[model samples]
Target: MFTGIVEELGEVTRVEPGDGVTRLVVRGPVVTGDAKHGDSIAVNGVCLTVVELSGDEFTVDVVPETLRRTSFDGVEPGRRVNLERAMAANGRFSGHIVQGHVDGTGTFLSRDHDGLTHFAYPPELSRYVVEKGSIAVDGISLTVAEVTRDEFAIALIPTTLAATTLGRNEPGDAVNLEVDVLAKYVEKLAAVHLPSAAVDNGGGEEDR
Candidate 1:
């Protein structure tokens, strides 16, 4: 699990394409300071396993499925990515729970001077978003300030602007988005119980 708190902005150094997978080498001195082979790291909200490590750089392989689902499908060298080490067992949860699993991709819409940034929600994923809920964008946990049919907004502090790649994102860019897992579970439970509760209440007609 991760907290979605970005540790650093890393750059992709190389991308080697294989038959069905691609190997990515990223330069992140801070995140690799204590990282080891086989460790899990969040690269732009996607959990990647370390396959190799060199000075200030680590490598991971992205499979076809991952590429198709994430914005990394056409990732190239020099692309900046948000990097974060997996949360330690006794670590503080500075941000909300992030699984490093991108539910879908959202398009960067626009930004405001008052720190409010907007992202266009994917139609299939909009049902998972709600006002005041937690959402992870490019691996940074942010609270939803507003929600609409096609977009959602969040307030980004100066620290976030400086610490994550989100600060550099432009309109029309694609971003990885993960909705709150808890909210998804709650919705599932309500779907199962609400109908039963209605039936127990005389189906709303027998009572009258």
Candidate 2:
């Protein structure tokens, strides 16, 4: 598991497409400093296992399913991606629990002058987002400053803008999004006591 804390703004050095898997090589000195084979690394919020390591670069194979569900479907070389190694068992938990599993993708809609960035998320994810709740956008955990029926906003500090890929995001660019896993767990646990149809069908008033 990851903490949704970006340790390096890595560069994608190569993307080699194959029959069923795409090989991705990324350059991240900090994350690769002590990396080994089979270690998991969160690349742009998607947990990918390192299959090979060379110098400061590591390669991971991205399958079709991962590409379809993430912003990496047609990801190209030279793209800047957030990178974080799996959190150490003894490490401090600085950020919220992040699985590095992209639930879906969101669109970068706009950014206000004061760094209040707005994003349009899939409607299915709306119930999982709340004002002041934690959300992971491209692997960088951020607090939801506001939420609407179709979108949410985040007040990005200078540090976030400088440290993560959000700084370079364009208006129409797609971003990987992972809502708080605890919220999903709560919904699942609550479903047992609440009406089954409402929860099972995922069609009811927001659970809050």
Candidate 3:
């Protein structure tokens, strides 16, 4: 698991294609300072296992499924990606839980000078978004400032604008988006028990 806190901006050094997967070599000196083979590193919010390490660069293989679901389908060398090492057992939880699993992708709609940035939400993923809720965009955890049927806005502080790939995103760019997993779990549980709970409460009707 990840905390959605970006540690550094890493640069892709190479992208090699295999029969069924693509291998990426990324340079992240800071995140790999003490890294080892098999460590988990989040690249643009997608959890990738470290397959090899050389100097400040590490390699990871992206499977077909991950490529299909994420914006990494056509990733190329020299691309900048948000990088975060998995949180340590004793580390502070600075951000919300992030699974590094991209649920879908959204298009950058607009950015405002008033700290509010908006993204056009894909129709299928809109139901999981809500005002004041937490959402992960390209692996950065942000709070939903507002929500509409087709879009949502997040208030970005200067730190956020400077820290992650979001700072460089322009209108029409695609971004990986992961909705709050807890909310989905809660919704599922509620759906499963609501009927029974209603019956136990006399279906909202008073009984003498």
Q: Top TM-score: which candidate number? A: 2
Give the per-residue lDDT of model 3 (tens digit) for 1-208.
8899999999999999999989999999999999999999999989899999999999999999899888898898999999999999899998899888887888898888976999987876676798898999999989999998889999999898998898899899889998898876766656656776432222321110
Residue range with the least summed lDDT across 10 consecutive positions in model 3: 199-208
lDDT of 1 by residue, 1-208 (tens): 9999999999999999999889999999999999999999999999899999999999999998888888998999999999999999999989998988888889998999988999997876677788998999998999999999889999999999988887899999999988887866666656656766432222111100
After TM-score superposition, the amount by which residue 38's alpha carbon in candidate 1 deviates from its true location, in angstroms, is 1.0
Q: Measured by TM-score, how close is model 3 to the native structure?
A: 0.91
Instruction: Write down the lDDT of every candidate, Cα atoms only.
Output: 0.88, 0.92, 0.87
Please state the error at residue 87 of candidate 1 in Å: 0.4
Model 2 residue pairs with clashes: none
Q: After superposition, how far is residue 141 of candidate 1 from its true place, in Å?
A: 0.4
**What order do you get sorting by TM-score, best first?**
2, 1, 3
Q: How many pairs collide in each candidate, listed in order?
A: 0, 0, 0
The TM-score obtained by model 1 is 0.91
- Which residue segments of model 3 deviate by more than 4 Å? 194-208
